[model samples]
Target chain A: MRGFLVLRVVAKLLMPFMLLFALYVQFHGDFSPGGGFQAGVIFAATVIFYALIFGLPAARQLVPEALVETMVALGVLVYAGVGVAGLLLGGNYLDYFVLAHSPVHGQERGIFWVEVGVAITVSGVMLKIFYMFAGRQRSAEDE
Target chain B: MAALTLGIALQRNLYAVVVLSGVYSFLMATALVALDAVDVAMTEASVGAGVSTVLLLGALYLCGGEEAKPLTRPWLPLVIALVIAGALVYGTLGLPAFSDPMAPIHTHVVPRYLHDALKETGVPNVVTAVLASYRGYDTLGETTVVFTAGAGVIALLRRIRRRKDGEQEAP
Candidate 1:
């Protein structure tokens, strides 16, 4: 708390790269050593870092509580919706082979959307949990 | 690794225990890398070592910094733990050697996945192909599980917050 200036400056310097690296991990998952889960966690960690430095209210303004809850639901819907699309296309549930013009493209497209869904849900849940815990302590103090 | 676990077990201070547990997670992540499970390693390093520690520290803040010393000698729990450990170690002896290509799992659906994942799924990473394409339903189920857990926590907290508000209004 004493050296607030140093912490703030360093956090500002680090956050963009952290977010970028998270994106890299998210997209490069098909070829490398990361995926939705890791990327989502890293993204959440960056935001949590900002919250720690700037305060929870600032973080909440940046990512509103309502939006976070919607994200948790929306990601699941996106994931399940892809499966329903597959079923409508005459494939079985979650069958990606018929998603596009060819099986290869379809598979890629399906995987991409699925991973995106995973990342969204994971990140939203992480931030939501953090907010609950941190917010609980704050409200207790306010009382 | 054993040393870290020992330290965590022996540490009387709750804060030190939390930090040591995180260190153990980091070490587990490193070991996963050596095993060539890079994706899992990344998950462990980030989720286990990073986020869990912060959450635990938040919990500690609510509770207190120091652990309350248990007065009773924990003989029964210790014995149960020892028995469970022994059973687990015994169970491991039945597993095939590490990376044994001829193992039942490697010879099973894994062959089909390894051979056809890239050709059929258009993904270079077999793990991604398996998780998102071949086993898409399972992944969907897992995502739903995550959603439910988050919702559960949120619902629980919201009620308490509302109750608190009601009390304040009563005043």
Candidate 2:
């Protein structure tokens, strides 16, 4: 992988835009046809692209397995945490009306945070699955 | 589309099957967009065409790239598929036409989602507003389900290898 100079250079040139597109999909989801799920897949696809062009170790160094695993849970926690926050803010469970001063703003805010959580979890899971398949037998076989 | 799908089902080469499936997914996404379901279109394109192909290739790397030869004819599967397709088409006969505004669900449930979604959630996409705010509990459950699925796979697949130097997965 390191020897594929053209691939390495092309991947380097492409990754930044991939990352930016993922972000665009994430934030514009509320207005556009995409939301967290699609955005997360795109984001994970970008990371997986990098791993394909570079080595898995390089990608793993960039995003530790530990962090990815944590992200898998943290997303759910964040989603549920928002619901709890709604409750603590004097509304029912998962209520967005109490999340901010105005109910509309609260709804928007809640959706935003929830989308973020979803994005994090989905991307993490996708990467973890890729890593699990690529890592274990791979390293042993490589050496 | 049928040609691509037939190529996928009939191809003995696992790599060609994967590639054909990717093309099938892209076509499916285009069809979804034509149906005015852009959200679903995006998901189908990204998840189906992109990552899953790579994942399948990775799996092929471990196992042999060739699919195993079947000992018998695949007639039973063909019959089953035809039966299921017949049943599905029969079922669809009773349903409203595609994108029919007068359809039951459209008349019953979708109006409010389309009308009040923006005013209620300040989100322009009715689908997002419905998923995130109106059906918030379901979305939360969906997220939890995704997390649980990931955890389940990790539990099943993660092997603690005993290296010579006592190396380990990071905590």
**Most accurate candidate by TM-score:** 1
Give the DockQ (C-alpha) for candidate 2.
0.75
Candidate 1 per-residue C-alpha lDDT over A1-143 given as tens digits, one digit per residue, 9 for 90 to 100: 43699899999999999999999999999999788888989999999889989999989998999999898998899899889999999898898888999999999999998999999999999999999999998987886
Q: What digit string (tens of lDDT, one per residue) describes model 1 on residues B17-59? A: 9999999999999999999999999999999999999999998
Candidate 2, residue B51: lDDT: 91
- Calculate DockQ per candidate and list them: 0.87, 0.75
lDDT of 2 by residue, A6-125 (tens): 999999999999999999999999999888888888989998998888889899998899999999999888899999999999999999999999999999999999999999999999
TM-score of every prediction relative to native: 0.96, 0.93
Candidate 2 residue-wise lDDT, B1-171, digit = tens: 988877877899999998999999999999999989999999999999999999888888777778899999999998999999999999999999977878899788788888889998999988899988999899999988889888887886654444323665545
Judged by whole-model lDDT over C-alpha atoms, candidate 1 comes out at: 0.91
